[model samples]
Target: MPAKQRSFAQTLNAVAWSFIGLRRRRDFDEDVGALNPFYVIAGGVLGCALFIALLLGAVRLAVA
Candidate 1:
């Protein structure tokens, strides 16, 4: 029998989970619980900015 290969979406999900510390289950949960609302808001804003930048880059390439 052969092992199944991970899909691109699964790989990306793993990467994002690791980045947010979910790889360390207990610590990640505790850290998330301890996080302040302001920090959460800041992270949301940063994520939005990053997403917007990617979208803009794609649009520019399409226009070119």
Candidate 2:
């Protein structure tokens, strides 16, 4: 099977989905071949940062 072409948005979306723990086997398989490593790394880092920021904000809000 041919690899599916993925854009930067797609890579970012995939990384977000992964962080959210929602993924299908088919999509994972497609991403394996289509996603650029550099894009994935960048997306993952950005996603992690956003996630951390959100969590920190929530925690601060709860504590205050």
Best by TM-score: 2
For residues 1-64, write the lDDT of model 2, one tens digit per residue. 7787789999999998988889888999878989999999999999989989999999999999
Q: What tens digits encode model 1's per-residue C-alpha lDDT throughout 5-57?
A: 44444444444565565666764455444545454555556656877898999
For candidate 2, the TM-score is 0.86
- Assess the local accuracy of residue 32 in candidate 1 as a C-alpha lDDT between 0 and 100: 49
Query: Once model 1 is optimally superposed onto the true structure by TM-score, how far is the C-alpha of residue 1 displaced, in angstroms?
Result: 47
Model 2, residue pairs in steric clash: none
User: Per-candidate TM vs. native?
Assistant: 0.51, 0.86
